[model samples]
Target: MFLLLVQAISLLLVPPLQSYHLDNAFGNPESVWNSLYYVVLLLLFTGAMLIIVRYKVNWLIQAIMAVAVLSTLVYVLFGLAVLLVPSVDPLIAGGVSVVLSLLLTALLIVYPEWYIIDTVGVLVAAGASALFGISLAILPTIVLLVILAVYDYISVYKTKHMLKLAEGFMDLKMPIMFVMPRRWGYSFMENNKGLPAEGAEREAYFMGLGDAVMPTMLAVSANAFLSAPPLLGFVNVPALGCILGTLVSYVVLMYIVVELKKPQAGLPFLCTGAIAGFLLGCLAAGVRPF
Candidate 1:
């Protein structure tokens, strides 16, 4: 539901983002080449992350994380401030957001309590999801999701390096994943030793922020790129379908997690749900998503 709300808001933000010429990341919405470039960029970044982890470059990793957190907050806050405070000077709004984002990023790095992590993680996820959604149209977004889902599967099962990355991230106390306690008085800062074993029962449940962000891009894309009449607020039929499909898939994914009790790639299930729902919605609306 949190994801849904965020994406819905993102759909609305598309127009304001467009006012700032923020839509279409490459200045072209349906560029297959741009999508491929994005994938390659992801691959390179992953390789760099792996190397940093392998070398135990904790400071470098933390520094990188800090910059990333600041940038994400800046993007989210700048857009929001610009929209909400139209009377205020744009520079002042932007300055205020940057200052606030800096403080939040500092706090996240310095403290990193569970509540703090969850709070920052949600804002960051929402911002990233919405940014990518408006940036890519339906087809390119689909391509990105498909490639990510496949890569997630391979990195989890075949290479198993993703698990390692998760551990490194946890150890660094990064807020890139959401943490929920199963029992009272659990401290992620102090008690999070590492990723639990396959059979181990964890004190907390963790979901990668990316898991939520990936499918959301599709919903945002559907809303932004397609010109179906708005059914509720800014939501169109196709975008609504993607949202519902993701929610349904989330339920199924939870069931699978409870039953299997092992690490699973979420993008496969989530991306498929979003895509399927989108196609069905396109059919019902008599419009093409692409």
Candidate 2:
């Protein structure tokens, strides 16, 4: 439960990063490269998980996790500093960044229970989403979402190799996933090989980090790119619409995954809801489709 909360919190780092990137600069090439960068990050995560699983190098795994967690905090700080600093100093900020990153890394190394893992997962998810959101415009976000949805379906249903990645993470007990235990006594530590079986229907629930990241890219893109009247704080109509839409879709999908007793690709549902809501909001505002 504590770990889940950590993961959820980690997911929040994206909005500010998106806002920062958009406010600072804009270009198609940048967005293209940003998308490529995410691909690399995904591959890196997969590789790390594979290595951890193969070697049973718990220390190495902890180090990687610490780095991920600290990197998220750095992104958060970078976004916050953007609002405060007179002039951006990626260099001077670099020093402070290293210190903070090291401290978080140390903590993860010292103690890595479910709570620590979940907290770090949430931060990493948020940071990744924000960066991607800011980097991608609406069109690119849409393209990315569509492509990934197809890829996810193919990988899960056709190739079946994606399960290998999931298996790797499950074996490592990495906090890079969200866990829902069916029974009260279900223990993550007990089953290091993979998710433990609980009953006839299902033993536990886990959603990969990508599930959160992929949808959020669209949410942030909607907020940053689509023009909308403010609804609350600085958030606008399209952004709010996307947020609500994603949440609604998430609820529906969770129900399906739980009740139907089947695995589901998250982005298809989440992105659909977000895009649909954004379009609806735009229509309500009398904005024409581009």
Candidate 3:
């Protein structure tokens, strides 16, 4: 439920971000090569993160992630501030965004509570999805999703390095992952000591922020690039289908998680569902599925 809500909210932010021309934080909008650049950058960052974890340079990784989180928050917040008050000065809005982002980052670094991490994680995920969604067109976004889904599968199942990454991230308690407590009394700080015992009852659930961000990249792109009439006032038929499909897959993913009590590669199911839903939506809307 929480993850779905975050995805929906991220989708909602797309049009506004597009209106403000705030998407594509990292690439040239006119070039078809942007997708390739993005993929390469992603791989490089992943390698860097793995090296950071391998070397136990927790503070450096956390600092790098904090800067990323702050920048995205400011991007989204500045756009939102301008949208709410069109006459507001960009400088003032930007200053406010910086301050807010700084405070949020401070909270994450100083306190590092589960709820705080989750809240900030959602905002960062939303901002990133919106940015990337508008940056890439349909075909490129599709390519990105397919590549990421494959990479996620390999990282999790074949190499199993993703598991190591997860363990390392748990130690930092950064907003890179969302935390869902299964029990009333759960302490993220305490749980960070180590991975859970194999057969022990888990006290909380953890899902990568990427799982929410990736499918949402498609939803935001659909909303931005497709001209289909709105199916429900806010989203077009195709985008809505993508969102619904993701939710359906999420339900299935959760079922497997709860039933089997094991870690799963979320992007495989999520990306597949999103792509299938997108194609179905395109068909219903009489748009090309490419």
- lDDT (Cα atoms) of all candidates against the true structure: 0.83, 0.62, 0.82
The best candidate by TM-score is 1
Best by lDDT: 1
Q: Relative to the unseen true structure, what is the C-alpha lDDT of residue 69 in candidate 2, on a scale of 0 to 100?
A: 70
Q: Where does model 1 exceed 4 Å of error?
A: none
lDDT tens readout by residue for model 3, 1-290? 66676666666677567766777565665465776787799889888989999999988988898889889899877766776787888789889989999999899888888888888888888888888888878888888888889999999889988888888878777748888898877879777654565555678888998999889888888888889879666688898889988889888998988887778899999999999898899999998855
Give the worst 10-residue stretch by lDDT in candidate 3.
24-33
Please provide, for model 1 over 97-131, each residue's C-alpha lDDT reduced to its tens digit, 9 standing for 90 to 100. 89999999999988998889887887788788888
- lDDT agreement of model 1 with the native: 0.83
Residues 1-290, model 2: lDDT tens digits: 33223223323444445444533333562355555555566667666777666777766765676666777678755655554563777666657766765665565455544545555556666666766675677776766777777767777668755666677656656556766666787666764456333233666677777777777766666656666676644556666666667778888888988776766777777778777877776776665535
| Alpha-carbon TM-score of each model against the true structure | 0.95, 0.75, 0.93
- At residue 106, candidate 1 shows an lDDT of 90
What is the lDDT ranking, best to worst?
1, 3, 2
Residue ranges of candidate 3 with Cα displaced over 4 Å: 26-32
Instruction: State which candidate, 2 or 3, has the greater TM-score.
Output: 3
Alpha-carbon shift of residue 26 in model 2 (angstroms): 8.9
